[model samples]
Target: MRHTRRRLTWRGTAFLVGAFAAACTLVNVVPHGTILERPFVVEGPVGETLDLSYAELTVTEVRTADTLESSFEQAVAGGTFLVVDATWRATDGYIVFAGAEVIDAEGRSFWATSRGGCAKGTNSQPGYAWRATYCFDVPRDALAGATLRLARGTHGEDDAGQRRDAVAVVDLGIGQHDVNELWDATEKISIEMPGFASAPATDAGGEG
Candidate 1:
Protein backbone atom coordinates (compact mmCIF):
# COMPACT_ATOMS: atom_id res chain seq x y z
CA MET A 1 0.00 0.00 0.00
CA ARG A 2 2.81 2.45 0.81
CA HIS A 3 4.55 1.70 -2.47
CA THR A 4 1.29 2.26 -4.38
CA ARG A 5 0.79 5.61 -2.64
CA ARG A 6 4.34 6.70 -3.51
CA ARG A 7 3.80 5.74 -7.14
CA LEU A 8 0.54 7.72 -7.33
CA THR A 9 2.19 10.75 -5.78
CA TRP A 10 5.04 10.63 -8.27
CA ARG A 11 2.59 10.43 -11.18
CA GLY A 12 0.61 13.38 -9.84
CA THR A 13 3.75 15.47 -9.42
CA ALA A 14 4.94 14.63 -12.92
CA PHE A 15 1.53 15.57 -14.36
CA LEU A 16 1.59 18.92 -12.60
CA VAL A 17 5.08 19.70 -13.90
CA GLY A 18 4.04 18.81 -17.45
CA ALA A 19 0.95 20.98 -17.16
CA PHE A 20 2.95 23.92 -15.88
CA ALA A 21 5.44 23.57 -18.70
CA ALA A 22 2.62 23.44 -21.24
CA ALA A 23 1.04 26.56 -19.78
CA CYS A 24 4.34 28.43 -20.00
CA THR A 25 4.79 27.35 -23.61
CA LEU A 26 1.28 28.48 -24.49
CA VAL A 27 1.80 31.85 -22.87
CA ASN A 28 4.98 32.38 -24.84
CA VAL A 29 3.24 31.43 -28.11
CA VAL A 30 0.23 33.68 -27.55
CA PRO A 31 0.32 37.25 -28.78
CA HIS A 32 0.10 40.08 -26.28
CA GLY A 33 -2.41 42.93 -26.30
CA THR A 34 -2.60 45.50 -29.08
CA ILE A 35 -1.92 44.22 -32.59
CA LEU A 36 -0.58 46.85 -35.00
CA GLU A 37 -2.03 45.86 -38.31
CA ARG A 38 -3.55 47.97 -41.07
CA PRO A 39 -7.26 47.58 -41.50
CA PHE A 40 -8.40 46.21 -44.84
CA VAL A 41 -11.30 47.78 -46.82
CA VAL A 42 -12.10 51.43 -47.47
CA GLU A 43 -15.34 53.01 -48.71
CA GLY A 44 -16.17 55.57 -51.44
CA PRO A 45 -15.68 55.93 -55.19
CA VAL A 46 -12.68 56.40 -57.41
CA GLY A 47 -13.44 59.81 -58.84
CA GLU A 48 -12.39 61.10 -62.27
CA THR A 49 -8.62 61.02 -62.86
CA LEU A 50 -8.05 58.14 -60.41
CA ASP A 51 -8.66 60.44 -57.48
CA LEU A 52 -10.64 58.28 -55.05
CA SER A 53 -12.86 60.04 -52.48
CA TYR A 54 -14.58 56.94 -51.15
CA ALA A 55 -16.99 57.19 -48.20
CA GLU A 56 -16.02 53.65 -47.12
CA LEU A 57 -16.09 50.33 -48.92
CA THR A 58 -18.32 47.76 -47.26
CA VAL A 59 -20.02 44.42 -48.06
CA THR A 60 -23.64 43.69 -47.09
CA GLU A 61 -25.89 40.69 -47.69
CA VAL A 62 -29.27 41.77 -49.06
CA ARG A 63 -32.34 39.58 -49.68
CA THR A 64 -34.81 40.84 -52.22
CA ALA A 65 -38.19 39.50 -53.34
CA ASP A 66 -36.95 39.33 -56.92
CA THR A 67 -33.18 39.14 -57.23
CA LEU A 68 -33.05 39.20 -61.02
CA GLU A 69 -35.30 42.19 -61.38
CA SER A 70 -33.49 44.13 -58.67
CA SER A 71 -30.02 43.40 -60.03
CA PHE A 72 -31.12 44.39 -63.51
CA GLU A 73 -32.61 47.65 -62.30
CA GLN A 74 -29.54 48.52 -60.25
CA ALA A 75 -27.16 47.89 -63.17
CA VAL A 76 -29.21 50.16 -65.39
CA ALA A 77 -29.31 52.93 -62.79
CA GLY A 78 -25.47 53.10 -62.50
CA GLY A 79 -23.71 53.40 -59.12
CA THR A 80 -26.78 51.80 -57.56
CA PHE A 81 -25.29 48.41 -56.81
CA LEU A 82 -23.01 48.00 -53.78
CA VAL A 83 -19.45 47.81 -55.05
CA VAL A 84 -16.18 47.00 -53.24
CA ASP A 85 -13.79 49.70 -54.28
CA ALA A 86 -10.07 49.11 -53.49
CA THR A 87 -7.44 51.80 -53.04
CA TRP A 88 -3.84 51.86 -51.75
CA ARG A 89 -0.99 54.12 -50.63
CA ALA A 90 2.75 53.52 -50.72
CA THR A 91 4.39 52.33 -47.50
CA ASP A 92 8.10 51.68 -46.82
CA GLY A 93 8.92 54.18 -49.54
CA TYR A 94 7.20 52.32 -52.35
CA ILE A 95 4.49 53.36 -54.80
CA VAL A 96 1.54 50.92 -55.01
CA PHE A 97 -1.54 50.73 -57.26
CA ALA A 98 -4.68 48.73 -56.57
CA GLY A 99 -7.81 47.49 -58.39
CA ALA A 100 -10.80 45.17 -57.85
CA GLU A 101 -13.01 42.55 -59.56
CA VAL A 102 -16.48 41.07 -59.04
CA ILE A 103 -17.41 37.39 -59.35
CA ASP A 104 -20.91 35.97 -59.45
CA ALA A 105 -22.21 32.67 -58.10
CA GLU A 106 -22.17 31.14 -61.58
CA GLY A 107 -18.43 31.85 -62.08
CA ARG A 108 -18.93 34.96 -64.23
CA SER A 109 -16.26 37.59 -63.52
CA PHE A 110 -15.40 41.24 -64.30
CA TRP A 111 -12.37 43.31 -63.24
CA ALA A 112 -11.34 46.97 -63.25
CA THR A 113 -7.84 48.42 -63.62
CA SER A 114 -6.20 51.76 -63.02
CA ARG A 115 -5.53 53.52 -66.33
CA GLY A 116 -3.51 56.67 -65.90
CA GLY A 117 -5.40 59.11 -63.66
CA CYS A 118 -4.17 59.16 -60.08
CA ALA A 119 -0.60 59.14 -58.83
CA LYS A 120 0.81 57.24 -55.86
CA GLY A 121 1.91 59.02 -52.70
CA THR A 122 3.22 58.39 -49.18
CA ASN A 123 1.20 56.58 -46.52
CA SER A 124 0.54 59.78 -44.60
CA GLN A 125 -1.20 61.26 -47.67
CA PRO A 126 -2.75 58.78 -50.13
CA GLY A 127 -2.73 61.43 -52.87
CA TYR A 128 -5.35 61.43 -55.65
CA ALA A 129 -7.74 58.51 -55.91
CA TRP A 130 -6.96 56.00 -58.66
CA ARG A 131 -10.32 55.01 -60.06
CA ALA A 132 -11.47 52.13 -62.23
CA THR A 133 -15.02 51.01 -63.05
CA TYR A 134 -16.09 47.39 -62.38
CA CYS A 135 -19.60 47.00 -63.77
CA PHE A 136 -21.39 43.66 -63.83
CA ASP A 137 -24.46 42.90 -65.94
CA VAL A 138 -26.48 40.52 -63.83
CA PRO A 139 -28.03 38.01 -66.16
CA ARG A 140 -31.77 37.64 -66.02
CA ASP A 141 -31.42 33.91 -65.32
CA ALA A 142 -29.56 34.20 -61.95
CA LEU A 143 -32.25 34.79 -59.34
CA ALA A 144 -32.11 32.69 -56.16
CA GLY A 145 -28.34 32.67 -55.81
CA ALA A 146 -26.16 32.28 -52.75
CA THR A 147 -23.79 35.29 -52.68
CA LEU A 148 -21.43 37.57 -54.64
CA ARG A 149 -17.78 38.12 -53.80
CA LEU A 150 -15.55 41.11 -54.53
CA ALA A 151 -11.82 40.33 -54.87
CA ARG A 152 -9.16 43.01 -54.79
CA GLY A 153 -5.70 42.86 -56.44
CA THR A 154 -2.69 45.05 -55.73
CA HIS A 155 0.27 45.38 -58.12
CA GLY A 156 3.40 47.47 -58.02
CA GLU A 157 7.22 47.32 -58.11
CA ASP A 158 8.96 47.95 -54.81
CA ASP A 159 12.33 49.60 -54.16
CA ALA A 160 13.94 46.21 -53.56
CA GLY A 161 13.44 45.20 -57.23
CA GLN A 162 10.48 43.03 -56.26
CA ARG A 163 6.84 42.94 -57.37
CA ARG A 164 4.08 42.68 -54.79
CA ASP A 165 0.54 41.25 -54.92
CA ALA A 166 -2.21 41.79 -52.33
CA VAL A 167 -5.77 40.53 -52.35
CA ALA A 168 -8.93 41.00 -50.21
CA VAL A 169 -12.44 39.56 -50.25
CA VAL A 170 -15.93 40.93 -49.39
CA ASP A 171 -19.42 39.46 -49.71
CA LEU A 172 -22.46 41.46 -50.93
CA GLY A 173 -26.10 40.93 -51.90
CA ILE A 174 -28.47 42.00 -54.65
CA GLY A 175 -31.54 43.85 -53.42
CA GLN A 176 -34.88 43.84 -55.21
CA HIS A 177 -35.22 47.43 -56.40
CA ASP A 178 -34.35 49.89 -59.12
CA VAL A 179 -30.70 50.86 -59.48
CA ASN A 180 -31.46 54.49 -58.61
CA GLU A 181 -32.93 53.49 -55.27
CA LEU A 182 -29.99 51.18 -54.69
CA TRP A 183 -27.57 54.03 -55.09
CA ASP A 184 -29.48 55.95 -52.46
CA ALA A 185 -29.33 52.92 -50.18
CA THR A 186 -25.56 53.04 -50.32
CA GLU A 187 -25.75 56.06 -48.05
CA LYS A 188 -26.77 53.77 -45.18
CA ILE A 189 -23.67 51.57 -45.43
CA SER A 190 -20.53 52.33 -43.46
CA ILE A 191 -16.95 50.93 -43.27
CA GLU A 192 -13.80 51.29 -41.16
CA MET A 193 -10.63 52.67 -42.76
CA PRO A 194 -7.18 51.77 -41.44
CA GLY A 195 -4.99 54.55 -40.14
CA PHE A 196 -2.40 55.30 -42.80
CA ALA A 197 0.34 55.88 -40.24
CA SER A 198 -0.39 52.68 -38.32
CA ALA A 199 -0.32 50.26 -41.27
CA PRO A 200 1.68 47.05 -41.04
CA ALA A 201 5.37 47.26 -41.75
CA THR A 202 5.11 44.72 -44.56
CA ASP A 203 2.16 46.70 -45.90
CA ALA A 204 4.11 49.93 -45.66
CA GLY A 205 7.64 48.58 -45.57
CA GLY A 206 8.21 47.67 -49.21
CA GLU A 207 8.95 50.22 -51.90
CA GLY A 208 6.59 50.34 -54.84
Candidate 2:
Protein backbone atom coordinates (compact mmCIF):
# COMPACT_ATOMS: atom_id res chain seq x y z
CA MET A 1 0.00 0.00 0.00
CA ARG A 2 2.90 2.42 0.76
CA HIS A 3 4.53 1.63 -2.62
CA THR A 4 1.26 2.26 -4.43
CA ARG A 5 0.87 5.69 -2.80
CA ARG A 6 4.47 6.57 -3.73
CA ARG A 7 3.89 5.67 -7.36
CA LEU A 8 0.68 7.75 -7.57
CA THR A 9 2.47 10.75 -6.02
CA TRP A 10 5.33 10.45 -8.51
CA ARG A 11 2.91 10.29 -11.46
CA GLY A 12 1.06 13.36 -10.23
CA THR A 13 4.27 15.32 -9.79
CA ALA A 14 5.44 14.38 -13.27
CA PHE A 15 2.18 15.42 -14.82
CA LEU A 16 2.30 18.80 -13.08
CA VAL A 17 5.88 19.36 -14.19
CA GLY A 18 5.03 18.54 -17.80
CA ALA A 19 2.10 20.97 -17.77
CA PHE A 20 4.23 23.73 -16.28
CA ALA A 21 6.85 23.24 -18.97
CA ALA A 22 4.21 23.49 -21.71
CA ALA A 23 2.81 26.68 -20.18
CA CYS A 24 6.27 28.21 -20.07
CA THR A 25 6.91 27.31 -23.67
CA LEU A 26 3.68 28.95 -24.77
CA VAL A 27 4.46 32.09 -22.78
CA ASN A 28 7.82 32.38 -24.48
CA VAL A 29 6.85 31.23 -27.95
CA VAL A 30 3.44 32.81 -28.67
CA PRO A 31 4.40 36.48 -28.44
CA HIS A 32 7.57 36.15 -30.48
CA GLY A 33 5.77 34.03 -33.02
CA THR A 34 3.02 36.61 -33.50
CA ILE A 35 5.55 39.42 -33.75
CA LEU A 36 7.49 37.69 -36.47
CA GLU A 37 4.35 36.88 -38.40
CA ARG A 38 2.87 40.37 -38.28
CA PRO A 39 3.34 42.75 -41.20
CA PHE A 40 5.11 46.08 -40.84
CA VAL A 41 2.05 48.29 -41.03
CA VAL A 42 2.40 51.91 -42.15
CA GLU A 43 -0.73 53.77 -41.11
CA GLY A 44 -1.99 57.24 -42.02
CA PRO A 45 -5.15 59.22 -42.69
CA VAL A 46 -6.56 60.00 -46.08
CA GLY A 47 -4.75 62.61 -48.24
CA GLU A 48 -1.50 61.95 -46.37
CA THR A 49 1.36 60.01 -47.88
CA LEU A 50 2.73 56.95 -46.07
CA ASP A 51 6.09 55.34 -46.77
CA LEU A 52 5.62 51.58 -46.81
CA SER A 53 9.25 50.55 -47.36
CA TYR A 54 8.80 49.31 -50.91
CA ALA A 55 6.44 52.07 -52.07
CA GLU A 56 4.73 55.31 -51.12
CA LEU A 57 0.93 55.39 -50.97
CA THR A 58 -1.53 58.22 -50.69
CA VAL A 59 -5.29 57.87 -50.56
CA THR A 60 -6.36 61.02 -52.40
CA GLU A 61 -10.13 60.90 -52.24
CA VAL A 62 -13.07 58.91 -50.93
CA ARG A 63 -16.54 59.07 -52.34
CA THR A 64 -19.71 57.01 -52.73
CA ALA A 65 -21.55 56.86 -55.98
CA ASP A 66 -24.74 55.33 -57.21
CA THR A 67 -23.30 54.80 -60.64
CA LEU A 68 -19.83 54.22 -62.13
CA GLU A 69 -19.08 55.28 -65.70
CA SER A 70 -16.28 54.14 -67.98
CA SER A 71 -15.64 53.88 -71.72
CA PHE A 72 -16.37 50.16 -71.80
CA GLU A 73 -18.74 49.29 -68.95
CA GLN A 74 -21.16 50.90 -66.53
CA ALA A 75 -22.16 49.52 -63.13
CA VAL A 76 -24.84 50.45 -60.66
CA ALA A 77 -24.31 49.65 -57.04
CA GLY A 78 -26.50 47.06 -55.32
CA GLY A 79 -25.54 48.58 -52.07
CA THR A 80 -23.56 51.81 -52.27
CA PHE A 81 -20.32 51.97 -54.22
CA LEU A 82 -17.38 53.20 -52.17
CA VAL A 83 -14.78 54.70 -54.44
CA VAL A 84 -11.24 55.18 -53.18
CA ASP A 85 -8.71 57.08 -55.29
CA ALA A 86 -5.08 56.48 -54.45
CA THR A 87 -1.57 57.18 -55.72
CA TRP A 88 1.27 54.72 -55.43
CA ARG A 89 4.94 55.39 -56.16
CA ALA A 90 7.26 52.42 -56.07
CA THR A 91 10.70 52.85 -54.56
CA ASP A 92 11.77 49.32 -55.38
CA GLY A 93 12.86 48.44 -58.91
CA TYR A 94 9.65 46.89 -60.16
CA ILE A 95 6.71 46.00 -57.98
CA VAL A 96 3.15 44.93 -58.44
CA PHE A 97 0.76 46.26 -55.84
CA ALA A 98 -1.47 43.23 -55.43
CA GLY A 99 -3.32 43.47 -52.16
CA ALA A 100 -6.21 45.90 -51.77
CA GLU A 101 -8.92 45.57 -49.16
CA VAL A 102 -11.11 47.79 -47.03
CA ILE A 103 -11.38 47.01 -43.37
CA ASP A 104 -14.35 48.53 -41.59
CA ALA A 105 -14.49 49.64 -38.00
CA GLU A 106 -16.00 46.33 -36.95
CA GLY A 107 -13.09 44.39 -38.53
CA ARG A 108 -15.12 43.32 -41.52
CA SER A 109 -13.07 43.23 -44.74
CA PHE A 110 -14.16 44.10 -48.28
CA TRP A 111 -12.05 43.39 -51.32
CA ALA A 112 -11.87 45.86 -54.16
CA THR A 113 -14.01 45.17 -57.21
CA SER A 114 -12.84 45.42 -60.83
CA ARG A 115 -16.11 46.72 -62.18
CA GLY A 116 -16.17 49.70 -64.56
CA GLY A 117 -12.42 50.08 -65.18
CA CYS A 118 -11.61 50.24 -61.50
CA ALA A 119 -8.24 48.81 -60.61
CA LYS A 120 -8.05 45.84 -58.26
CA GLY A 121 -4.27 45.79 -58.58
CA THR A 122 -1.63 47.93 -60.24
CA ASN A 123 2.03 47.76 -61.32
CA SER A 124 4.66 50.46 -61.12
CA GLN A 125 8.36 51.05 -61.63
CA PRO A 126 10.60 53.18 -59.42
CA GLY A 127 10.16 56.45 -61.29
CA TYR A 128 6.78 58.09 -60.75
CA ALA A 129 3.56 57.60 -58.82
CA TRP A 130 0.75 55.69 -60.42
CA ARG A 131 -2.81 56.86 -59.84
CA ALA A 132 -5.64 54.37 -59.52
CA THR A 133 -9.18 54.10 -58.26
CA TYR A 134 -10.61 51.13 -56.37
CA CYS A 135 -14.26 50.53 -55.65
CA PHE A 136 -16.19 48.31 -53.27
CA ASP A 137 -19.85 47.51 -52.87
CA VAL A 138 -20.64 47.76 -49.21
CA PRO A 139 -23.59 48.30 -46.95
CA ARG A 140 -24.34 51.59 -45.20
CA ASP A 141 -22.89 50.37 -41.93
CA ALA A 142 -19.47 49.77 -43.48
CA LEU A 143 -19.17 53.37 -44.62
CA ALA A 144 -18.11 54.60 -41.24
CA GLY A 145 -14.53 54.19 -40.09
CA ALA A 146 -13.43 52.31 -43.17
CA THR A 147 -9.73 51.88 -43.83
CA LEU A 148 -7.89 50.92 -47.00
CA ARG A 149 -5.06 48.40 -46.87
CA LEU A 150 -2.70 48.18 -49.84
CA ALA A 151 0.31 45.95 -50.15
CA ARG A 152 2.67 44.41 -52.67
CA GLY A 153 1.52 40.97 -51.58
CA THR A 154 -1.89 39.61 -52.36
CA HIS A 155 -4.17 39.05 -49.40
CA GLY A 156 -5.06 35.41 -49.10
CA GLU A 157 -6.48 33.31 -46.29
CA ASP A 158 -4.74 34.14 -43.00
CA ASP A 159 -2.89 37.05 -44.68
CA ALA A 160 -0.76 34.51 -46.51
CA GLY A 161 1.26 36.77 -48.82
CA GLN A 162 1.38 39.81 -46.52
CA ARG A 163 3.34 38.16 -43.73
CA ARG A 164 6.44 40.06 -42.61
CA ASP A 165 6.03 42.61 -45.42
CA ALA A 166 5.49 46.36 -45.46
CA VAL A 167 1.82 47.24 -45.87
CA ALA A 168 0.01 50.57 -46.25
CA VAL A 169 -3.06 51.10 -44.05
CA VAL A 170 -4.82 54.38 -44.84
CA ASP A 171 -8.00 55.63 -43.21
CA LEU A 172 -10.76 56.81 -45.48
CA GLY A 173 -11.93 59.40 -42.87
CA ILE A 174 -15.60 58.57 -43.19
CA GLY A 175 -17.19 59.02 -39.83
CA GLN A 176 -20.57 57.82 -38.56
CA HIS A 177 -22.01 61.25 -39.19
CA ASP A 178 -20.94 61.15 -42.82
CA VAL A 179 -22.63 57.82 -43.44
CA ASN A 180 -26.17 59.03 -44.03
CA GLU A 181 -25.14 61.82 -46.39
CA LEU A 182 -22.81 59.59 -48.38
CA TRP A 183 -25.35 56.81 -48.62
CA ASP A 184 -28.14 59.14 -49.61
CA ALA A 185 -26.22 60.93 -52.34
CA THR A 186 -26.92 59.56 -55.80
CA GLU A 187 -23.98 60.91 -57.73
CA LYS A 188 -22.08 59.58 -60.72
CA ILE A 189 -18.29 59.24 -60.66
CA SER A 190 -16.30 59.45 -63.87
CA ILE A 191 -13.47 57.02 -63.23
CA GLU A 192 -10.42 56.78 -65.43
CA MET A 193 -8.19 53.76 -65.68
CA PRO A 194 -4.95 53.53 -63.75
CA GLY A 195 -2.32 55.86 -65.20
CA PHE A 196 0.83 57.75 -64.35
CA ALA A 197 0.03 60.55 -61.91
CA SER A 198 2.47 62.89 -63.61
CA ALA A 199 0.11 62.91 -66.57
CA PRO A 200 -3.59 62.66 -65.66
CA ALA A 201 -6.19 62.14 -68.37
CA THR A 202 -6.22 65.95 -68.40
CA ASP A 203 -3.45 67.89 -66.71
CA ALA A 204 -4.39 69.42 -63.37
CA GLY A 205 -1.20 67.54 -62.55
CA GLY A 206 -0.07 67.56 -58.96
CA GLU A 207 2.83 65.46 -57.75
CA GLY A 208 1.43 62.14 -56.60
Candidate 3:
Protein backbone atom coordinates (compact mmCIF):
# COMPACT_ATOMS: atom_id res chain seq x y z
CA MET A 1 0.00 0.00 0.00
CA ARG A 2 2.76 2.45 0.83
CA HIS A 3 4.54 1.80 -2.46
CA THR A 4 1.34 2.36 -4.42
CA ARG A 5 0.65 5.67 -2.62
CA ARG A 6 4.14 6.98 -3.42
CA ARG A 7 3.73 6.25 -7.15
CA LEU A 8 0.35 8.06 -7.28
CA THR A 9 1.83 11.16 -5.57
CA TRP A 10 4.68 11.35 -8.12
CA ARG A 11 2.20 11.00 -10.98
CA GLY A 12 0.03 13.82 -9.72
CA THR A 13 3.05 16.10 -9.29
CA ALA A 14 4.24 15.40 -12.82
CA PHE A 15 0.82 16.12 -14.28
CA LEU A 16 0.59 19.42 -12.46
CA VAL A 17 4.01 20.48 -13.73
CA GLY A 18 3.11 19.63 -17.31
CA ALA A 19 -0.14 21.62 -17.12
CA PHE A 20 1.70 24.64 -15.75
CA ALA A 21 4.26 24.56 -18.55
CA ALA A 22 1.55 24.40 -21.17
CA ALA A 23 -0.24 27.33 -19.65
CA CYS A 24 2.96 29.35 -19.64
CA THR A 25 3.54 28.59 -23.29
CA LEU A 26 0.05 29.71 -24.21
CA VAL A 27 0.46 32.98 -22.31
CA ASN A 28 3.62 33.78 -24.21
CA VAL A 29 2.78 32.52 -27.70
CA VAL A 30 -0.91 33.23 -28.10
CA PRO A 31 -2.07 36.63 -29.37
CA HIS A 32 -4.31 38.16 -26.74
CA GLY A 33 -5.47 41.74 -26.25
CA THR A 34 -1.92 43.00 -26.00
CA ILE A 35 -1.07 46.39 -27.43
CA LEU A 36 1.69 44.81 -29.48
CA GLU A 37 -0.93 43.05 -31.59
CA ARG A 38 -2.89 46.19 -32.47
CA PRO A 39 -2.53 47.89 -35.82
CA PHE A 40 -0.36 50.95 -36.40
CA VAL A 41 -2.11 54.24 -35.52
CA VAL A 42 -1.58 57.55 -37.37
CA GLU A 43 -2.54 60.70 -35.51
CA GLY A 44 -3.29 64.26 -36.66
CA PRO A 45 -5.18 67.37 -35.63
CA VAL A 46 -8.31 69.12 -36.92
CA GLY A 47 -7.97 70.74 -40.39
CA GLU A 48 -4.76 68.82 -41.07
CA THR A 49 -4.83 66.31 -43.88
CA LEU A 50 -3.63 62.82 -42.90
CA ASP A 51 -2.69 59.79 -44.93
CA LEU A 52 -3.43 56.20 -43.99
CA SER A 53 -1.40 54.53 -46.72
CA TYR A 54 -4.56 53.87 -48.82
CA ALA A 55 -6.58 57.00 -48.21
CA GLU A 56 -6.35 60.69 -47.36
CA LEU A 57 -8.63 62.01 -44.57
CA THR A 58 -9.20 65.59 -43.52
CA VAL A 59 -11.14 66.68 -40.47
CA THR A 60 -12.80 69.90 -41.52
CA GLU A 61 -14.94 71.01 -38.58
CA VAL A 62 -15.75 69.87 -35.05
CA ARG A 63 -18.72 71.34 -33.23
CA THR A 64 -20.53 70.72 -29.93
CA ALA A 65 -24.24 71.20 -29.52
CA ASP A 66 -26.83 70.61 -26.84
CA THR A 67 -29.49 69.92 -29.42
CA LEU A 68 -29.41 69.15 -33.14
CA GLU A 69 -31.96 70.89 -35.34
CA SER A 70 -33.14 70.52 -38.88
CA SER A 71 -36.02 71.32 -41.19
CA PHE A 72 -37.74 67.97 -40.73
CA GLU A 73 -36.57 66.20 -37.56
CA GLN A 74 -34.94 67.31 -34.32
CA ALA A 75 -32.62 65.19 -32.23
CA VAL A 76 -31.55 66.32 -28.80
CA ALA A 77 -28.33 65.35 -27.11
CA GLY A 78 -28.33 63.78 -23.67
CA GLY A 79 -25.13 65.62 -22.79
CA THR A 80 -23.87 67.05 -26.03
CA PHE A 81 -23.56 66.14 -29.66
CA LEU A 82 -20.14 66.18 -31.24
CA VAL A 83 -20.54 66.94 -34.92
CA VAL A 84 -17.51 66.15 -37.06
CA ASP A 85 -17.13 67.22 -40.69
CA ALA A 86 -14.63 65.16 -42.63
CA THR A 87 -13.67 64.49 -46.21
CA TRP A 88 -12.10 61.35 -47.61
CA ARG A 89 -10.15 60.80 -50.80
CA ALA A 90 -9.33 57.20 -51.56
CA THR A 91 -5.98 56.45 -53.13
CA ASP A 92 -6.38 52.72 -53.62
CA GLY A 93 -9.57 52.15 -55.57
CA TYR A 94 -12.94 51.96 -53.83
CA ILE A 95 -13.29 51.24 -50.12
CA VAL A 96 -15.41 51.95 -47.10
CA PHE A 97 -14.37 53.86 -44.01
CA ALA A 98 -15.50 51.50 -41.26
CA GLY A 99 -14.16 52.56 -37.90
CA ALA A 100 -15.23 55.78 -36.15
CA GLU A 101 -15.18 56.68 -32.46
CA VAL A 102 -14.25 59.28 -29.91
CA ILE A 103 -11.66 58.71 -27.21
CA ASP A 104 -11.86 60.95 -24.19
CA ALA A 105 -9.08 62.00 -21.87
CA GLU A 106 -9.76 59.05 -19.58
CA GLY A 107 -9.14 56.65 -22.45
CA ARG A 108 -12.82 55.91 -22.62
CA SER A 109 -14.12 55.32 -26.15
CA PHE A 110 -17.53 56.27 -27.52
CA TRP A 111 -18.72 54.96 -30.85
CA ALA A 112 -20.20 57.23 -33.46
CA THR A 113 -23.93 57.95 -33.16
CA SER A 114 -25.99 57.49 -36.30
CA ARG A 115 -28.81 59.74 -35.21
CA GLY A 116 -30.19 62.61 -37.29
CA GLY A 117 -29.53 60.59 -40.43
CA CYS A 118 -25.86 61.35 -40.12
CA ALA A 119 -23.31 59.30 -41.99
CA LYS A 120 -21.69 56.94 -39.53
CA GLY A 121 -19.07 55.99 -42.08
CA THR A 122 -18.19 57.07 -45.58
CA ASN A 123 -17.68 55.11 -48.78
CA SER A 124 -15.00 56.36 -51.10
CA GLN A 125 -14.05 55.93 -54.74
CA PRO A 126 -10.80 56.71 -56.53
CA GLY A 127 -11.99 59.72 -58.46
CA TYR A 128 -13.09 62.60 -56.21
CA ALA A 129 -13.36 63.40 -52.52
CA TRP A 130 -16.40 62.37 -50.45
CA ARG A 131 -17.79 64.40 -47.57
CA ALA A 132 -19.30 62.94 -44.39
CA THR A 133 -20.55 64.10 -41.06
CA TYR A 134 -20.30 61.88 -37.97
CA CYS A 135 -22.22 62.69 -34.85
CA PHE A 136 -21.41 61.43 -31.35
CA ASP A 137 -23.63 61.99 -28.33
CA VAL A 138 -21.43 61.95 -25.27
CA PRO A 139 -21.34 63.32 -21.78
CA ARG A 140 -20.08 66.79 -20.94
CA ASP A 141 -16.78 65.44 -19.68
CA ALA A 142 -16.01 63.57 -22.90
CA LEU A 143 -15.38 66.77 -24.85
CA ALA A 144 -12.22 67.89 -23.10
CA GLY A 145 -9.07 66.56 -24.70
CA ALA A 146 -11.02 64.14 -26.84
CA THR A 147 -9.70 62.54 -30.00
CA LEU A 148 -11.58 61.02 -32.93
CA ARG A 149 -10.38 57.82 -34.58
CA LEU A 150 -11.40 56.57 -38.03
CA ALA A 151 -10.13 53.42 -39.63
CA ARG A 152 -10.40 51.60 -42.93
CA GLY A 153 -11.94 48.51 -41.40
CA THR A 154 -14.81 48.11 -38.98
CA HIS A 155 -14.33 47.61 -35.25
CA GLY A 156 -14.73 43.85 -35.59
CA GLU A 157 -11.98 43.65 -38.17
CA ASP A 158 -9.38 45.14 -35.84
CA ASP A 159 -10.71 43.96 -32.48
CA ALA A 160 -9.44 40.44 -33.14
CA GLY A 161 -5.88 41.79 -33.39
CA GLN A 162 -5.24 39.60 -36.39
CA ARG A 163 -5.41 42.16 -39.21
CA ARG A 164 -3.01 44.89 -40.21
CA ASP A 165 -5.03 48.09 -40.78
CA ALA A 166 -4.54 51.82 -41.06
CA VAL A 167 -6.19 54.17 -38.53
CA ALA A 168 -6.46 57.96 -38.48
CA VAL A 169 -6.60 59.70 -35.11
CA VAL A 170 -7.58 63.38 -35.08
CA ASP A 171 -7.78 65.71 -32.14
CA LEU A 172 -11.20 67.26 -31.44
CA GLY A 173 -9.52 70.42 -30.02
CA ILE A 174 -12.01 70.77 -27.20
CA GLY A 175 -10.47 72.74 -24.33
CA GLN A 176 -11.52 73.14 -20.70
CA HIS A 177 -13.23 76.49 -21.21
CA ASP A 178 -14.92 75.31 -24.39
CA VAL A 179 -16.71 72.52 -22.56
CA ASN A 180 -18.73 74.92 -20.40
CA GLU A 181 -19.45 77.23 -23.28
CA LEU A 182 -20.58 74.36 -25.50
CA TRP A 183 -22.84 72.77 -22.92
CA ASP A 184 -24.71 75.99 -22.16
CA ALA A 185 -24.98 77.28 -25.68
CA THR A 186 -27.35 76.21 -28.46
CA GLU A 187 -26.18 76.63 -32.00
CA LYS A 188 -28.15 76.27 -35.22
CA ILE A 189 -25.60 74.72 -37.52
CA SER A 190 -26.40 73.44 -41.00
CA ILE A 191 -24.88 70.15 -42.16
CA GLU A 192 -24.86 69.07 -45.79
CA MET A 193 -23.61 65.87 -47.36
CA PRO A 194 -22.25 66.32 -50.86
CA GLY A 195 -20.68 63.94 -53.39
CA PHE A 196 -23.30 61.45 -52.30
CA ALA A 197 -26.52 63.38 -51.98
CA SER A 198 -28.61 60.26 -52.33
CA ALA A 199 -26.93 58.71 -49.27
CA PRO A 200 -29.08 60.47 -46.65
CA ALA A 201 -30.88 63.73 -45.99
CA THR A 202 -29.34 65.43 -42.93
CA ASP A 203 -30.19 69.06 -42.21
CA ALA A 204 -29.49 69.87 -38.55
CA GLY A 205 -30.55 73.35 -37.53
CA GLY A 206 -33.41 75.42 -36.16
CA GLU A 207 -36.71 76.07 -37.95
CA GLY A 208 -36.03 76.84 -41.60
Best model number under TM-score: 2
What value of lDDT does candidate 2 attain over all alpha carbons?
A: 0.87
Instruction: Give the C-alpha miss distance for residue 129 in model 3, angstroms.
Output: 0.8
Looking at candidate 2, the ten consecutive residues that score lowest on lDDT are: 199-208
TM-score of 1: 0.29
Poorest 10 consecutive residues of model 3 by lDDT?
199-208
| Location of the lowest summed lDDT over 10 successive residues in candidate 1 | 113-122
Residues 86-163, model 3: lDDT tens digits: 877778999888888888999888888766656678797765667788888899888899999887777663454224
Error of 3 at 83 (Å): 0.5
Clashing pairs in 3: 69-204, 69-205, 70-205
Winning candidate number (lDDT): 2
| TM-score of structure candidate 3 | 0.76
C-alpha RMSD in Å of predicted model 2 compared with the true structure: 6.7
CA lDDT, candidate 3, residue 128: 65
lDDT comparison, 1 vs 3, better candidate: 3
Count the clashes in each prediction. Answer: 20, 0, 3
Q: All candidates' lDDT scores?
A: 0.32, 0.87, 0.76
TM-score of each: 0.29, 0.81, 0.76
**TM-score winner, 1 or 2:** 2
